[model samples]
Each structure stands twice: as C-alpha cells, then as structure tokens.
Target: MPEKTIPILPCRTLQPVLDFYTALGFEVTYQQRSPNPYAVVERGGIELQFFAMKQYEPAVSISTCYVLTDDVDGLYQAFRAGLKETYGRIPTRGLPRVGPLKDMTYGVRQFLVTDPGGNCVRVGQRTGGERHHGPAPQETFARALHFASLLADSKGDPAGAAKVVDRALALTDETPTRVQLLQLLVLRADAAARLGDEEAAVTGLARAAALHLTAAERDQGRDALTRLADLRGSLRP
Candidate 1:
C-alpha cells in the first residue's frame, strides 16, 4: 500500500496557495489538474496536500494539518525576508486573524497565520531538538496513529505521549490499521513503562508483541519491551 498523504486545508484558490507555498521554499511533490485539482507540498518528511474546495468559507475543522520544522526561526526569517524582497511587506501579518509570533509553553516555538481563504495554518518548531516527523502512513488511520508517536517524542512529555496514543487507539478502535495500531500500542506501552505503570506496560507490550510487527519495527518494539522487562525484572529478584 502506498503511504497516505495528509490533507492540509480545503482550499478554493490554488494559485495563491501554490504561490505562497512555493515562495516559502516548499516544492510540489504531486500535482493534479482535473476533476478537483490539488497539490502536495513536501519538505523533509513533511507532506501536506491542498485540496480544492468549492466552498470558500472557513468551516470548523479539527486540523487543517500541522507543519513541523527544524528551523522555525530560519523559516520565519526566510519567509519574512522573501516577503520584504517581493511585496515590501510580510504576507503573513496582513492576513486576517493573524497575530504576532508567540512562544508556546509546551516548548514549541510556533505561530499561526490564515491563508488567503481563511484556513488556519500553523508552523511549529519542536523544542529540545526532538523530532516531530516520523515514517509515512499507509492510510489515514495509520498516519494519525503514527502522529501520536511524533507528538510524544516531540514534546518530551510522557503523559502527553500516552494521551496521544490513547486517542489514536480510540479513533482507530473500530477499524484499526494493523501497522499503525500496533505501533501506537507499542508506543503507549513504552510511555507506560516510562511512567512506571507496570501493569499497563505489560499489557501493552503483550498486545503489541502478539501482532506481527514488521521486522524493523519489531526490533524496535522488542528493544523497548526488553528494557521494560529488565526494569520490572530487577525489582523481582
């Protein structure tokens, strides 16, 4: 199965969004012109698709999608400089509902800006050098499931990580994608072990190990399980 693409925002205008992303140094990885044109802009492991929507209003939506960048300041600076060089003003600030940059308490330096058509876009930089992007998902469920791992690792908050995994499990409960579901289970188990929740760790690891984790993923999970087992084992003898 091919990896799933994350939907960025439902867009009515393609040219402006395309131009905006292009100006931000994002390259188009995929583009289709028919039946509802769209484009996927990607950099590093980040992939986001802009879908053409006939409705131009900003509907209440959970995620227009998130962009994790290693160089938040540099990207912001670059965009600021590009705007100055092109239009003599920052294109971001002029947008409606946009605000000055603010440092988030979660250690993520980020800012929000509205697109030309009122879609909210967030650009975040994970603090403490933690990676926010992970392997691609084979489906939407898997993508969301994998996102839990990234969120946990990115924030360095074990509780937050566990919550994301639980959310993913709940969301994927009815029709779970094996790869992602198992991966998330393992991640949650790891988080549980980190928090010294022995019972939860054992249950999570047992469930994950029962699933046929991919060779590489299995190794990762096994390593994590081993560490947890060792920790628990030490207290026994």
Candidate 2:
C-alpha cells in the first residue's frame, strides 16, 4: 500500500500542536531543515506533516485529516476520555465540542475533533474492522524515548532525559519533530544550566532558536526564543 501524508497547519503554536499529536499516539518520522522545516508523523499507514508558517491567522476553513484505525468506537472513547481527563469537562459540552461517533455514508465510522488551531482531525476505523494492533517496530522505540522524556521531566533528571532523546534520534535517521527536539533541548538546557554548564544550555537554546529562523518557523520558534532569553537572564551572575 502507498503511504499517505497529511498536512498540519498551525497558526502560531507549533509546540502545542506537536504535543497534541504525541499525546494521541503518533510517531515522529521525519524533520526537514530547508525549503521550510516541517515534521512528519505516522500512525499505521497514515502520515501527518506540519507546515509551519510565520503567521497563521485563524479562520473557519474546513481542513480535514483522516486517521486510520481498526476500532473506531474504542478510539473515539479514548479521545473523549482524554479530553475529560485533561480539561475536567466532557469535550462535547463546549466550544470545539466533540462530534458524535457515527458511521459515515462512505462506510467509515468516525468522530471529529477540532484542534486548538482550528484543524479537524477525523478519527476512524472501519465497521466490523478487526483489531490488528501493535506499535510499528519504529514506534516502539519512539514511544520509549517519549516516555523517558516525560519521566525525566517529572523527576528533574536532565541527564536521563537527554539519554532518552538520544535514543529517539538513534531510532530514526531524522526526527522531523523539531518542536519535540526543541523541548528536549530546552530540558537539556535547564539541566545543563542547573548543573553549571551555562555554555551548553545556551548552545542548546541557540540551536532551538536557530530552527525558528526560517520564514515558516520564525513565529513558531519565538516562544522558545523568549523562554531561552529568560533562562539566560536568570543564570547571569
């Protein structure tokens, strides 16, 4: 089967966009550096890419992306549960309300979610579709790295966090997860700064800032830039 690619356009917050996908079980597959730095994530045969833009103003455009699955109902339940657990309310009750889980006329059972940036991520699995589920070999490593990074974050262990990131990089030749890499870099920056290696911290943050230098990434990278500056000021003698 031919691999499919989906485009993700975030108005200004690339980091949150990346976090949202990772939280939903997608794996980062590629990162581009030129002609614009973008990221590729894959779930099964479905691949999603981010098209970072300098300025993205919100609009009521119907940008839809399809996610393939073997259990549409189970997936929908998980999605609803996630929203409730994170926001303390059912996702169907308010703005960006969760749409119902129903079988479309086209033979796919799906539910829709409007991302914070206003993109619709449609999750679906075929009716009567048997669950042939497990992470791809590559995803297993990617998830491990992600989990370790989370653990490192909560435990204040930058060294351990860095190790996980290194493992993630090793799994894929190029992780188009610039935002995720930047985050890990930020963690490393904090870890380095705390451990008395101000130079390393600056270097990590600088690399992250440099990522935003592209036309598409300028605004996306600004948050990291501002954050780094704050760190720098705090570390000054």
Backbone clash total, candidate 2: 2
TM-score for candidate 1, residues paired by index:
0.46
The candidate that wins on TM-score is 1
lDDT of 2 by residue, 38-63 (tens): 77766666667776676764345456
Query: Considering summed lDDT, which 10 consecutive residues are worst modelled in model 1?
Result: 92-101
**TM-score (all chains, Cα) for each model:** 0.46, 0.43
Counting clashing residue pairs in each candidate, in order, gives 0, 2
Candidate 2 backbone collisions, by pair:
30-176, 31-176
- Can you give the lDDT of residue 56 in candidate 1? 64
What tens digits encode model 1's per-residue C-alpha lDDT throughout 87-178? 44444222322222434435576655555545666787877554443346666556654455455444335678788677667763366656
Off by over 4 Å in 2: 1-3, 8-10, 29-37, 93-97, 127-237
Q: What is the lDDT of residue 237 in candidate 1?
A: 25
Off by over 4 Å in 1: 1-5, 58-63, 92-99, 128-237
